[model samples]
Target: MQIILAATPVVLLIVLLGFLKLPGEKSALITLGATILIAIFGFSLSFGDTALSIGYGVTKAVFPILVIILMAIYSYNVQVKSEKIEIIKQQFSAISKDKSVQVLLLTWGFGGLLEGMAGFGTAVAIPAAILISLGFKPMFSAVVSLIANSVPTAFGAVGIPVIVLAREVEMTDQITLISSHVVWQLAVLMFLVPFLIVTLAEKSVKSILKNILLSVLVGTVTLAVQYYAAVYIGAETPAILGSIASVVVIIVFGKLTANREVKDSYLNFSFNQIFQAWSVYGLILLLVLLTSPLFPFTAFMKANWDIFQTNFNFNVAGTLHTVGIYWLTDTGVLIFVSSLVGGLIQGLSLGSLFSLLGKTTIQLKKTVVTVCCLISLSTLMDFSGMITVLGLALATATGALYPLFAPAIGALGTFLTGSDTSSNILFGKLQATVADKIGADKGWLAAANTTGATGGKIISPQSIAVATTACGQQGNEGVILKKAVGFALLYILIAGIVVYLGS
Candidate 1:
């Protein structure tokens, strides 16, 4: 009964969003209300506790999550308004006429770069929008972006997910070991996702054979770079450097294989014109790198500015829940600033820039409400002990076979919370405990949690919301989810097998 009650909200959400094809905002709002009722009556949670939990969740949803989505869309809007996206599309076309190669470069290579640098949905939102602008179907753009966003998530936001997992499980001393385990667990998928996205884009098995060499090259380079970086350079730079390497390889590959006509198109643009067209993204990358973990400015800001950080504590159902916000370091602020400056550089006036931002906010209002409600639902479940009950039940049921199911647990957390880092926090310690009970390597299982969370990102409603909104398919989230769920399941199944064998 308790387990059923704990899972009711999730079940209801799936039915409404996945089956009934309801709008995300309506579905999430309905589920949130149901969750509140369950928490208050079924779980004996007080009204005060429920309210506090909702507050914390709303704050979190707005600051880094919704804010990031808002700004990412605004940045794209800035490009469209300034007519730079047209030039950007032409530049990509010049690189390769094959849609498969274009999809591979944009979704797999460039999307991974965004995930590594800033994450928080920039990977899915920015790249999906760009793909749509480049003439891909909206649904195709969203689904492929979601798929490509998966593997890079383990090291996203400069490796915050793994770093948080290490901290949560109190294995900071073994961070290197844990990072290596995560890369290995994700090894096969990292190499194969490029092929998956390309085939899906081309809509044919023949496309895989046709582009086999390029796919293999991309997969090999990305996997090798991530493995070495995770093992030697530490967790902070693997995704960042690996993604950069993927981009470089694709460009070089495209150049060497270019037809005379394609080469002519590439030559039609001056270096300055190309730079101006890509200036928005360039500024975003530069800003992200400057404030990334590799830089001293990030540390200096956190140390010198008290207002750069915000933390709120809520006593929910007798437990303390703290929501922390890092303002200055947030990807949203960086992207927002970069887009504003980039727009100005592209000849847009300040008035027009603010006008674009306003329009963007209006366009994404439904997404805002949906994200907030979903986050609040997750928080209520956590505060009411529903999530713990579910996790423990799965661990106990699987027992010795828990290794095969470890990634599923991580995926569940990400599905509920919509973040790889938050998923790790929710289940990292539980994974370690289960490892001890089942005689598995603690680090391996803990790392599996992060790896699994990456797969979950593919189907996370928060992720779907961002993708749909970016591609101007907001109300069709269910259509996209229905298409994406199969890939997400396959990803988790493969992850589970890898973890099981490795364990």
Candidate 2:
């Protein structure tokens, strides 16, 4: 009875967000409030402890995400005000003449770029909008974009899933991260699979999936370099490194392909055009690099912040957890600086710049709130032990098939919440602990969990929302999810089989 009621919020969230097309923020708040009431009266946790637990739950999530979200918002603002992002997108003009390459590049390569730089479904949303603009049907654009977004998720935001999983599984340092680094880097290589499909659809796939071969060949090099980075240099930079590597690969491949075919269209973008358009992209890369371990960029950037932080520890009904939370200006500061820099470079006024920020905020309010609420509720469930209890029950039900379900569990968490990092937090440690108790290969199990979770990226309600918004199907995400459910499930099953075979 306790478990069922305790699990109500999650189940409700899934159904409401996933099925009913309810707004995520409202559902999360309603469900969270209900869970709190149950925890207080039915489960009999004290009011203060319940409140503290909720606070702690939200705290764990907010710290890491705040900067990420703020960076995304600011970066977006910079893109719009400076017109530099427009210049970058202009590179796709020649390709847009062919729907196939349009889908392939924007949906796959561009998707990976967004996933690497600013994950959390924006990859899907932003790209879907571009695809829609390029003349694809809205639903198809949403579906393809959703599918394309998966490959880079394992390494999204600099391999955050593995990092979260590593910390949860108690890996203090290098030993914990190498394999995960390899996993995500490998996932980056897998990105080519979707690209090949997009190519096939484009009819430019040469009847033999030629682009796939090229992608795979290039992916191999990217993965090889990324693995080296993870094991020897640093796991933290895998996404950034791999993305840069793949971009170079694509540019080379483009040159080779164009040289062989000698298409006049490819020759259109002049040196000046390339320079003007890629400036913002270069700046984006610069900002991200500054935040790398190889540099003191993030630290230097963070130094300008005025942060309000609080730490608290507690024993809640004999269960213990500690909390650290921050309201920092780091991400906001980066965005502010970037916006100013980008605007100045593009010749925008101070008033116009503020207007861009305002418009971006107004547009993003619902998205940010939905994301924040989901994090708060998810964290609360985790901190309260409710998620563990429910997961244990589900794990018992799966029995020997737990391996298949492991990633599914991660995927399921992501499906509801729409963030892979959040999913890792929800299930990464729980899966590892179970694998150990059951004597499964820890590496294989970890891989399965990660792989399965990546598959769920497509069907996720939040992802659907991003896709719909990007595709301009704003209020009809549920329908988009329905169109996508078939592929999402197919991919999920395929990933499961792959994990099972490897295990």
Candidate 3:
């Protein structure tokens, strides 16, 4: 009965969003209300605690999460208004006329780079928008970007997810080991995603067979580079370096295999024009790298500049949660600044840029509400101990087979919270504890949580919201979710098999 009660909100969300085909905003709002009621009555959480959790969730959602989504969409809108995205689309077409090749380049390569650098929602929003502009179907573009965004997430935002997992499990000394475990667990899925992207784009088995070599080459490159980086370099640089390598491989492969007409089309653009069109993203990358943990500037600022940071503390059901916001160094701020400067470079006036930002905000109003509600629901579950109960129940029920379900717990956390880092924080310690009880390898099980989170990302409502907003398919999140859920389940199943066998 307790397990059933704890699971009600999740079930309600799927029914309303997937089966009822309701708009995300409506479904999230309804499910959030149900979660609040359950927390108060079923879980015996006090009203004050429930209210505090909701407030904290709303604050966290607005700051870094919603801020990232807004800036990503606004940046794309600024480019569209300036006609830079048009040239950008032409640049991609010039690289490869084959839609399958283009899909791999944009979604798997460039999308992974974005996820590695800035994460939050930029990976899905930016790449999905670019794919739509390049003439892919809107739903296809959203789903493929979501799929591509998965594996890179373990190292996203300079490996914050894995870093947080280490901290949560109190095994910071073994981070390199944990990082290696994560990449190894993700090895098979990393290779599988490229083939899936190509097949989805071409909608034919023949297309995948024709581009089989490219897919195989890309998968092997990403996996090998990422594994070496994780093992030798630590967590911060694997996704960054791996994605850079993938992009290079794809460009070189396109060049070597190009027909004369395609080669000429690629050469039509001037270096300056291409630079101007891509400046927004380039600036974002530059700014993110400058402030990333790979550099000392971020550490210096955090140590010396207290004024640039905002921290809020909330006590929910006897547990204290701290939410921090870095005003000067936040990726969303950098993205917004980059977009403004890039827009000016493309010849848009200051007033025009501001106008576009305002319009973009209005366009994403529904998305903002949906994300807030979903975050609030996650917060309520956490503070009420509902999520812990579900995790413990699953561990107890599985017993000797617990390793098979470890990844699913991680996936469930991400599905509820819409974040890999948050999922790690929620379940990393629990996985370690369960592993010890079952006499399994604790580090491997903890890493499995992170690997499984990549799968959960596909069906996350917050991710779906970002995708829909990016592709101009805002009210059709249910349709997109229905289409992508199958792939998400398949991904989790594979992760489960790998983890079970390894254990």
Candidate 4:
């Protein structure tokens, strides 16, 4: 009965958002109220501790996670206001005239690149918009963009998702272990997705059959580079490096298979112009790589940056909860500073850059509210032991078949929260707990949660809304959801099988 009541808030959240279609912010608030009530009365946690836990959760959400979102979106907005985005699109459209090949290059290759660079719906929104403008059907463009967005998401935003997961599990030393497990768990999807993209874009099997070798090449290069990076370089660099490497492979293959009779569309932008436009991302890549653990000065910088750090302790009953904020070493700062320098290099005036920053803040205000509330509620559940109870119940129910249901739980988290990072926050520890109970590999199980969250990207209401709104297909979200939910389930099923067999 206690566990059942513990699940009430989650149930209410799902029903409110999934069934009644309540706005996410409103649903979060309603569910948060329920969680606090349950924590105090049902779980017998002290009201003060529950409140402090909620506060801690909000701080974590704002600092680093929301901070990264603000910088990435601001940088993207800066590019848009400067018209560099148009040039970027013009360059991609120049790649090829064959719609199938273009789909592979733009949606799969370039979309993966964007996912690596920014990845807070930027991957889906930008690529879907470009595909629609390039003459693809609106719904098809949205589906392809969402599917491709899944490939690089675990390492999105310079690998913040895995970073956050590692922090939650309190196993920073095992970052390499967790990353390696996630890479292998996601390996099958990495190979399968390239072919799926081509098949989805082109309806006929004959068209897919013709492009089989090209699809295999894209998949092979992406997976190989991604695996190598995850093993050697750590999480921060893999997505960007892998995506760039795959793009090179695709180009080489395209040239080899080119029909001399057809002239490819020449890029309207000159080499210098292209360089200036993409310099923003190049700068961010450099800064992130320099500050990563692979560098010598990273430890020195982290120790010296204590001035920007925020640390606090709040007692939760007999226990103490500590929240540490490492501002200087945070990825948000790196991306924001890089954005400033990159904007200046691209010639945006200081005044215009600040203007773009202000606009970005305004644009994300609602998102800020939604994320804070949801994360706070999730933390409250965790502190009150509701999440653990639920995980125990799940493990008990599944028994020998627990592995098959693992990815389903992960998919459900993302479907509710619409963020792989948030899904990890809500469920990462739970996965670790269940793994211990079921005698499964703990690191791999924790990674299964994130890998499963990637599949939910397509059907996530937040993602679909971004894709449709960007493509001017607002009311067509239903149609787009119908198209994507199948692939989302397929991805989840495949992920479950991989985890089960590997275990």
Model 2 per-residue lDDT at 182? 34
Residue 8 lDDT in candidate 2 = 87
Instruction: Report the C-alpha lDDT of model 2 over 1-503, residue by residue, as the tens digit.
Output: 86797678867865766688776556666777777777677666677777777666555444444434444444555665566666555566543344555566666666677677656554676566666655568888878878877757776766667677667666646433535533542354265454544554565435346556656755675576566666765545555566567656655555555533445655465776565555544555556545544566545545554255445676656777765433332333444565566666666677887777677656655555555566656655665666667777878988887766676677776775567777777777787788898888665565555566677888776566556544546556556666777776766666665655555
* Candidate 1: worst-modelled 10 consecutive residues by lDDT: 203-212
Compose the digit string of candidate 1's lDDT tens values, residues 1-503: 88999989988998998999999999999999999999999998899989999998998899789999999999999999989889889878888887887888898889999999999999999889999999999989999999999999999999999999999989999898999999899888976788788778787666557577877888888889988998888888889888889889888887787788888767377786777778889999999988998889888987898777988887766677776767777789889999999998889999999988999999999999999999999989988889999999999898889999999999999999999999999999999999988788999999999999999999999999999999889889888889999999999999999999999
lDDT scores of the candidates, listed in order: 0.90, 0.62, 0.91, 0.75
Tell me model 2's lDDT, rounded to 2 decimals: 0.62
lDDT of 3 at 440: 92
Q: In candidate 4, what are the lDDT values of residues 265-295, reduced to their tens digit? A: 5556677788888877677667766665556
In what order do the candidates fall by lDDT, top score first? 3, 1, 4, 2
* Candidate 3 residue runs with Cα over 4 Å from true position: none
> Would you list the rank order by TM-score, best first?
3, 1, 4, 2
Lowest-scoring 10 consecutive residues by lDDT in candidate 3?
Answer: 203-212
Tens digits of per-residue lDDT for model 3, 345-446: 889999999989999999989999999999999999988888899889988998898888899999999999999999998899999999888799999999
Clashing pairs in 1: none
